[model samples]
Target: MAEMFSMLGTWNWLVLGLLLMGLELLAPGVFLFWLGLAALLVGLLSFALSLSWQLQILMFALFAVAAVPLWRRVARRNSGASQSNPFLNKRSDALVGRVFTLEKPIVDGAGTVRIDDTIWRVAGPDAPAGSRVRIVRADGASLTVAAD
Candidate 1:
């Protein structure tokens, strides 16, 4: 172990650290990130101070274990910052309670409506083209509507 440390250089640690960080891009979820960061920190420290393999390993382990929780705490605190708009991804849901004219006649609870340039399929009572309807909610890709 001592011989291995004697032979290993800070450059090796740096290379290993970079490789691990790169690997995190392929398999991501906050796992490799901490370890890779630990390796890089150890590498930097090694350059400033000569360290035995045991101390190096200890530092790496401490960094790995300690950093993640601290990061998670800060992350948890910051995440509470005005959550992303709830309506951002719910395109259909955003249309609920709004009124629009039908572009096609609804027959047996099926029809289409044009809002802007996009055509949306609607489910509601039978109505002729040009009839106004109010969106109730979204069901999958279709909207549930009622006569306005």
Candidate 2:
């Protein structure tokens, strides 16, 4: 078994890298891509030079150290400048700045407002039912409203 494992050479590493890359398609995140690149580099280096086990370990460690920070920097540059849609994954965020009519009177700073057939708990200065209110902000399932 040990001999069979030892027989795996540079080509095996290359194949492993391809497998990792293929897995990345199934689970698309930033992680496996770097590891696969490292493996591919190691395979090419092993093919070019007869590397000792210590050199192989050192190469893998160096690849990890270098690739992680570089990948993070690239990822941040790609993602940081863009504004994320507030409505993305949060449907209530779309209600901000929209106007609604109070369905129930706000007594002691709490009331309900009907928005698209759903009554949402609201907090604002005291207001009567049927008053026009604008959504100032959303807190969980509740809307912080103000007189429109």
Candidate 3:
């Protein structure tokens, strides 16, 4: 184990980095990808000069410090991209501003509506079944509604 650690070369480190990056495609998370980049930088440094163990460790620390924050920024931007996609996982909020007809009358502040083949619980002013309603807001899985 010690010998393997000591004998690691620039190409070997580069290969390990590529492997980690490939694994990130399957994992789809930010962590391994940055560490892989850090390892690749270490490999490039190793190829450029003969470094002592302490120097190698220091270089890795610096790479991590530089890469992690940059990776986090990119990940944050990518995650924010989903907010612009209308069909993303937002259930109730997606329903607001959409129109639906009540499948069952709203009596005592509760009823059901068929919205695109899905029945959802609704809260609004009393109305008979088949009346048009517009979703005003959403609370969890339920929608607050008003007459259309």
Task: Please tell me which predicted candidate would have the highest lDDT against the true structure.
Answer: 1
User: What is residue 135's positional error in candidate 2, in angstroms?
Assistant: 2.0
Clashes of 1: 0
- C-alpha TM-score for every candidate: 0.85, 0.56, 0.66
Q: Summarize candidate 1's per-residue lDDT along 1-148 as a digit string, tens digits.
A: 7787677678877887898899999998777877889899999999999997778888888998998898799789877763666676678888999999999999999999997889999999999999999999897679999999
**Could you give the C-alpha RMSD of every candidate to the true structure, in order shown?**
2.2, 4.9, 3.8
Rank by lDDT, highest first. 1, 3, 2
Q: Give the whole-model CA lDDT for all candidates, comma-separated.
A: 0.88, 0.85, 0.86
Give the lowest summed-lDDT range of ten residues in model 1: 80-89
Assess the local accuracy of residue 113 in candidate 1 as a C-alpha lDDT between 0 and 100. Answer: 98
What residue runs in model 2 are displaced by over 4 Å at the alpha carbon? 1-8, 18-32, 44-58, 79-96, 102-119, 124-130
TM-score of 3: 0.66
Rank all candidate structures by their TM-score, best first, as comma-separated numbers: 1, 3, 2
The digit string of per-residue lDDT tens for model 2 on 9-98 reads 788779878888889999999688788888788889999999865666578678867998999889888775554654666767889999
Error of 1 at 108 (Å): 2.0
Which candidate, 1 or 3, would have the higher lDDT against the true structure?
A: 1
